[model samples]
Target: MTDIAPPSPSSSAEPAHDRQNLIARQPILDDKRAVFGYELFDRSTAAAAHTAASDAALLFNALSYAGSEALVGRKTVFINCTHESLKGPHLELIHPERVVLKVQTLGEQATPEQIGELLPVFESLRARGFRLAFNQEVLRRAYASWLPQAAYIKLDLLAFKPELAEPLIKFARSYSAAALVAEKVETAEQYERMAALGVRLFQGYWFAQPTVIQAQTIRPSQATIVQLINMVRQQASLTEIEELLKKDPTLSFNLLRFINSSGFGLSCEITSFRHAVMILGLKKLFRWAALLLTTSRNTGSPPAVGQTAVVRGRLMELLAAELLQPEDCDNAFVAGVFSLLDVMLGVSLEQAFESVALPQPVVDAVLHGKGVLAPFLELTRACESADEEAFARCAQALHLSNRQVNWAHLQALAWAENLDQDE
Candidate 1:
């Protein structure tokens, strides 16, 4: 759960409008078990029927609130759409090649005529370069009009008996040219079975689950990343780090934003990469780089995980500012941001820490849950989650009032939102 700021006493107790958008994504993997794209949906309205309004809201939020890069990055995005939404103006906002629109049926028993009526709509979308995806229902003879337009066909493993999947797979392969995607695949057996049946794409919890690291290891790849890690590992000179930052525009931009972020508690803005490096010094810059890479990496985690970490880091820093020294506040921010490193890196925190050398205080709070900053970290998490009891306990432990915490929480949310907008 991302730590969302609570409303202030002067404001309405109702949640913010954007908070209600609550977007969630599931990774779609290829045969090599690498993430190929994502299936994004509105978690806030998961139980609601698929309607024009719901479809519009999901697309609008994904584009506006979540931002494209933060949501799916460079990966293909699969969005569910109602027949009505298929003709919506919202679909115009997306780049056709990057998005695959999953068309939903009218109901459990939609007629052949009803499905055929949307053929023109489907054709129009394809003409505009948008790819279409359909459920296993499209394999039925009744949905023949819809089959030819399908670029991908999804098979929900849990929707039918195990033996039934193979025949459906065979039937789809024999008749249609669409790529088969096995959905709701929950175990190694399910994934293997789907692969053996010639299914190349998969979506489910089995591959999405974070890897449990039983031993310490470093798996840095890419020349730039390896160089950066090596530089940090060797405690290279400031000049060397600055030269490297100058070579990579993306890293330079991230560095400037990171040091000047509201949570960093800087009195003035940092305008240059060199200035930021000198001000933050070598150690803090390494921490910032670790965070930037962890969140920005294409590690198959949703953009929300990185976004949530930024919020937590800012929230904790703001909360710490009220009671701790400036240095401790800085550490608090790192602790908050790095708390989710395990999930973002697809490894345990123990293994994540083994790869990067973070401050001992941040490590203690995140890894062992024993340190001066541990209670504040707990309080920050409480603000993001719905555990009211834990919230009160942690807040009381820190001797802070609800108003103070709420104010910080709200500020952190706004800060993170602003950062996304800048991006």
Candidate 2:
């Protein structure tokens, strides 16, 4: 898991998955208890946890899947980076202004040679508008030479004794340019202690725990999307679809907005529902409506959750493209996207199924996790969760190669990220 911005702090509703890579964001708060930013941590996927490959995947996923607009917006993004990640191509994918590279001091002591090697990299990043964060352990005399580059100093409240907190705070303050952060603070007393030491930034459950929202009530607009999906499945004419959309101004507005979104690739604006229908056609409209079901939420869930659902849908569809008939691909897509309806609609899977008129296969795949599409859904979940064994089994059962699954996973992530950018 990494901090790729999942659900909102108070609404912890997540997409349902048997296996998937978990990405959670822990809020970092300012002195006034306002959200400052987030420190991203990954629990799986990377070889050694903080290796270059994992870091690159996290960064790329964050930028593509969880953009700055969704996560921090204008706030700081504190990402832990190893020495190698500094030189990797993924770092170049994002702008540096809002990112704080938490450079890990490799050893207990930093040699002159190591310092010499890192300073130039630090200088280059700083010159390009990136800030560097350091842990308190970097405060040792052996690593003092790197102190000048520090932007934020993180102090683990759990690691340091209460008495040493003040000394560490004082020492961190001596830098004048660095902000002190007290992380892993779990109690009111710890927060108070850190506050007294002039630590303006804080992280931990003391302020707020990550809320888990299992499901959310579907909005009126979402119900319209369900209606539109039904209409599309029945092969309704443009006039009929347009009439249904016209009934709900909000529905019409969102359809137009989505069609105009960057993902649609339209040169001119689509001002009318009829025009949108003509441009997207029936099949594509069904897909778009399916996507809108999650994205156009009146519920307080994070947008990332909806985007994650979209990724799952795309991944399933991509996996089925080779093995299943062309018509079955649409069912696979619907199954994948609507699989999270139980969570997205705040209802049981059976109850959620009532809203959308889906095929028996799609229904079976989603409700019982049994059907031809079920393994694709499972493999898609495995990709997200990084369940290598499950992924292998599902892929093999479906006669899909490791490279095929990996390629589809990457494409789905890119597709989801592009969808967000289009909006």
Candidate 3:
């Protein structure tokens, strides 16, 4: 969607199904257990009884690339790369230093020459502030070639028989690669063993599990919004707006951070929120902040809950055009955003409605599921539950095409992904 160059790998693997399983990140730490970076990991439950590492690096790279603008505000992200990437469009957009590619040395008999042949690619990347690394198993003999070329390398402590760690550690130290990580180290004894061998980066259940980092909420001071709304519409002077912003220190500080963030690529350095206002003007600024308000409130709602509301809202609007009339889509969109506002805001709909006003019918549908949108909302919920019979009835009743319903599912995912990236 960001005009990424179309990639064609013609991979030996087939198309994947069942994206239900979640992916998590493992912290790449130092010997002191200080946070150094994160290693991306994926699990696939395509079957009930089995799940393991499935190559999700392609999707991970795409999601990370898409989410970088938002995530860059705090930490440096280390995205994983696959064997295919050394030759593709990924190199064009992302630098190597910011990424620690998880490459493997191929077959068991792979030689140092094979790894050395990839140096020209790594050298070009290093010139652009990129970093390279290998993962899991690496041969003792090939270490001479692979170790010299990389900044960091990871080896699973469990993968190597316990006795093999000493030699592996000795081999890793020979080239003095910046770091060697021992992953899947579960117990304190295992950790102590790796640490003694000088494996600084140890990752496993011993550390911590990945969590959905709560995006901080911006509780705009009542006065901040009042002043912003007033000054923005009048197209007030920069000095006057700066004086007004002095009313809310937090708003001013966050506004500066947001403008300076990768999300907004301003050509010149902006030192003040007033300058940000001057650059963006009131209309754009207000819309952006309002969206920030909504996204800040994304909270911990299950993703499927949000996706269903979007599909329901869109479907209802489409139905409105057929059965009701024009001028109804806005109501529908508002309905979608507010459907779970009570849950997201931690207050009943009645209590939350006092803070934000909506058209009566829109509020009715959200609060009581009563109005034209209600029926569509019901249908969307059924599809999410995979209720085939309910979906068929709703599709028939609404005269909606199967393709139309499926298209809405994808659209919802896209919209959520965008909202996620923007946040």
Candidate 4:
């Protein structure tokens, strides 16, 4: 995970890992958030607690802030680039959305020829599906040449990199690259400088750091668990799931939106909740709903913890379905979910899985990847969580293709998002 665009790794050994943390402020312009994107900024595959590895992870662990209700569908996220990810897989994760990359970070010192070599890489990545951004202090040679290809450019206005700001800003306007971002702006004066320079995207505490809201722990209340168990037991019919969902107006609304999202690629629109329930089946529906319920905060809880679990669980579960044998799909869901148990509830795995009624093997996989479903499930989970070590390890163990894993994940997200949407 050493910073690649369209992030795809060839080796299973190095672990698909990037440990970056970020504190971003959605630069509000015209009372609207500037197009803030998830910028990938750090790396480490350590599972001992993401924050334990580096301050960057701690800072950026909540990069998913864009995923929460606090910023959902509002700001874009720009993840940093990695070498392996330079030409291919990194772009898709943030497609039809905003993402930023440090193009030169793909190399340290570039010869003119090397810069030329990367031009196609940038071209191909953008074509694959990323709305790209550039972050650099020196916008010379290659970057200057590629500036035309960028969607946005970020200059460190606070540090005032004379070498970078002038040329990048000039070229950005000349090409109509979406907007310029003035990062690290501290004082009112700094913001004013960049703002005057036409750098509308500003990131710094002077504006605001994406605040960390303490997330509420949504225990699968006994009532919720009983309902889930009943749903899976097939006692809850298609009509019943639909009705039960309406009881939670928010869930009903999201499910409908998901059913129609581009992720599903549905030729015919999904118009009814009952129809969606029938298509998904009881097992998957309950697993998904219960998981979603568990992730929703009840009070003054940070949305990140829960939202990440929801996205990660849904992502891994869907991918694992394609890779695992029929018998292990639910096990896959459990594995994907528990992978982040430590982070969300801030507890040991043993404590987290203890409350849920899962098969021993599934529990084993979630806890230590100790069962047959563990590797594949963990592999899918790793990619979704962007945990390169787990993904690389699990992928190598299964001798699976990175391409296959990504395709599976994309299909899964698209599927879940659509299936959950009623409208």
Model 2 over residues 1-423: C-alpha lDDT tens digits? 121211121111112111133345678999998988877665434435556655654544343233223444456677888898798544543557657899878685656787679989988898877899988887877777778888888898887789999888777677547888888889999999889878899998887664321212233344556667777777778888865653343354345444553223345655455677887766556545544453444433234556677778788878899888976886787677677766765568886555333567887888888978888888888888867888789889988899998898899889766642332
Model 4: which ten-residue window has the lowest total lDDT? 1-10
Tens digits of per-residue lDDT, candidate 4, 299-397, equal 332245444444455556556665677446544554554566567546576754442234566667777768776666556657757578777777777
Error of 4 at 93 (Å): 5.5
Stretches of candidate 1 above 4 Å error? Answer: 1-19, 209-423
User: Residue 209 lDDT in model 3?
Assistant: 65
**Superior candidate under TM-score, 3 versus 4:** 3
lDDT of 3 by residue, 235-332 (tens): 67777776444333334434554555433444554544456677765555554443223222222322554444445555455555555655455465
Q: Count backbone overlaps in model 4.
A: 54
The candidate that achieves the highest lDDT relative to the unseen native structure: 1
Worst 10 residues of 1 by lDDT: 4-13
* Whole-model alpha-carbon lDDT for candidate 4: 0.49
Task: List clash counts for every candidate, in order.
Answer: 1, 9, 5, 54
Model 3 accuracy (lDDT, Cα): 0.54
TM agreement with the true structure for every prediction: 0.47, 0.47, 0.45, 0.42
Give the range of the ten consecutive residues with the poorest summed lDDT in model 3.
Answer: 11-20
Off by over 4 Å in 4: 1-74, 88-94, 98-102, 105-108, 161-168, 175-178, 210-423
What stretches of model 2 exceed 4 Å from their correct place?
Answer: 1-19, 209-423
